[model samples]
Target: MTAQQPAGGAAIPQRPAVDFGRRYITFETPRFAGRTPRRTMIVCAALALVILGAGLASLTLGAYEVSFGAVIRAIFDPASDPDARQVVFEWRLPRVLFAVLCGAALALSGGIFQSLTRNPLGSPDIIGFGVGAQFGVTLVMIVLELNTYLWKASGALVGGLLTALLVYALASKGGTSAFRLIIVGIGVSAGLGALTSWILITVSVEKAMMAATWGAGSIASLGFDQLAPAALVFAVILVLTLPLTRRLPVLEMGDDAAAALGIDAGRTRFAAVVLGVALIALVTAAAGPISFIALAAPQISQRLTRSNSPMGTLPVMLTGAALVVVSDAVAQLATVPVGVVTVSVGGIYLAWLLAAQYARRA
Candidate 1:
């Protein structure tokens, strides 16, 4: 125990720094207990290894067989094997990169939203931003016929921002609560989903088919052309997000407590929402609303690390990358879009979450 002198000159007991091996590490301050940077880095390394293994498996086991040696050679020296070069560099690599980036973005976004609302169910997907992005893409791709990467991306960003605005407006009338935001979000999401469906229904058959494929959320056709822009945006937004997340744990103590701690809970919440929405919208534009990654990744990361926070941002991001990359690989085997796989898997997980919540309440 450590002692501290206050204005009253009384010493209060404080827990000393604790390190529980490589598995867990933390330190206690006068204010709160938090994970050490080293512990977070270890978790990140472990998750990165999983993503790397999964990515390598993805690169090797595809439509055309390529040896591990061939993959390495193709990556390092593309001219050695034309087939390997084309398959690896021109095709598989972009898909894998998009999956990893998109997954990380969604996972980070989910963590922010979950932390802000203090609810497990509060994710970008559940709160309607995903649907709104889709709606925006539908308008750009189907109606405007400006289906280029940049245009589609812009549409998704605008749509997601609008949806977030609406959700905030509805929930903030009497001051926002997690429950109110979720309820309003569900209604907004349903409405936006219907609008997307209607757009699909009204388009020409050719256009409808194209839109449907995009909606299914396949990263198969994307190249560096799409990946570069999305990556740039994600990188910039992530830089902005990291500073805000330091204040996120403060909100868990409630608004008044957070205020007493000299944190602006409302401004922090708004910044978080804006950053989170931007992250998800970029992914949706790059890969279509891939579904449930934002919902599942952070929660899964939290459980794995046994952390009190919904998800340590780094772990959540790496976990999301792993989840999406692995799921993309599985979806490839089935010759289906990754979204199909995620939705099916996420639906079951959501059901289990609901059941557990009910059982706990009962």
Candidate 2:
């Protein structure tokens, strides 16, 4: 293309047209290079603010009723009121932080599976992984009589990975079909759930009650003792999974295409399943299986950012954190488990998603 001549007989340079639809901010460096949509960045910022607001509300609105100013002072100033310090720091702060971490972990796990299966319903909760983890914890507490955090975490991780393998084996007859995977997952989830129920009934009432309460998923009794170790494990798993996040999107292009691009499809899927199960196990060990945050957060983030693909891990994590913190605050007011609140909300979201999917098909 030639530059246009103006009345002055001089050529005027023409600038390339910018795509106003989805503006992206690109970065390149020796160590790393990537681009993110401006909308996604804004959405992430807003979600972060939501988490902050919800966390503050959780700290202030408990039965103890610490004022906002006192909450701030208790966190920052050592000389703050003793009662306020204990209430905010010892009682509430740990729970709030745990909620954030647990929510982010579950959401990340959900995003990994959803992207791998290339389906909206491909979450750990839907696919029996969460139930498998829960069953593991129950076995450790009830059958094996090993109720330590380490044993329960190990059980949950192993159970979740085994469930994932079973589902994959059942679904991969000719090739792994997304619809077949969901169906197989639902079946596996049902079987594990029934086994969990049988285990609960066979145990002593006190043990059963304790396991049941934990199974309902409450962050209420957790404090620094539980939070410290969980936080460390979460940090390690997150760092290990960071590189795999970029590879997952490539696998969505199909095994052959991914291989053509020098990506190992089978290895990526295996690693994602292991790491994703590890994430579920982390949360289940700390809090029992806190339901539905995993199922809802990634899809919600996708819709908010107007993205076709659910590869926006950061935004999904932020959305999950906000959901969990807010839900826990509500649960406190209702004197119920946070899991109950999440299930209620997530059920509604799941129904809507199904209806939307059916509508599109029709």
Whole-model Cα lDDT of every candidate shown, in order: 0.87, 0.91
Q: Give the range of the ten consecutive residues with the poorest summed lDDT in model 1.
A: 16-25
For candidate 1, what is the TM-score? 0.88
- What lDDT, from 0 to 1, does candidate 2 have? 0.91
Q: Per-residue error at 117 for model 1, in Å?
A: 0.8
The stretch of ten residues in a row with the least summed lDDT in candidate 2 is 307-316
Write down the TM-score of every candidate.
0.88, 0.94
- List runs of model 1 lying over 4 Å from the truth: 1-42, 76-79
- Residue-level lDDT tens digits of model 2 in 1-362: 45898988889888878766998989999999999898999999999999999999899977787999999999899998999999998999999999999999999999998998899999999989999999889888899889888999999999999899899999999887989999999999999999999888887999999999998999998999999999999999989888777788888888888899899887888889999999999999989989999889999998999977676778988988999999999998899999999999999999999999999999
Please, what are the lDDT tens digits per residue for candidate 1 over residues 286-332?
78879999999989988877677874777999999999999999998
- TM-score of candidate 2 against the unseen true structure: 0.94
**Displacement of the residue 3 alpha carbon in candidate 2, Å:** 2.7
- Best candidate, TM-score: 2
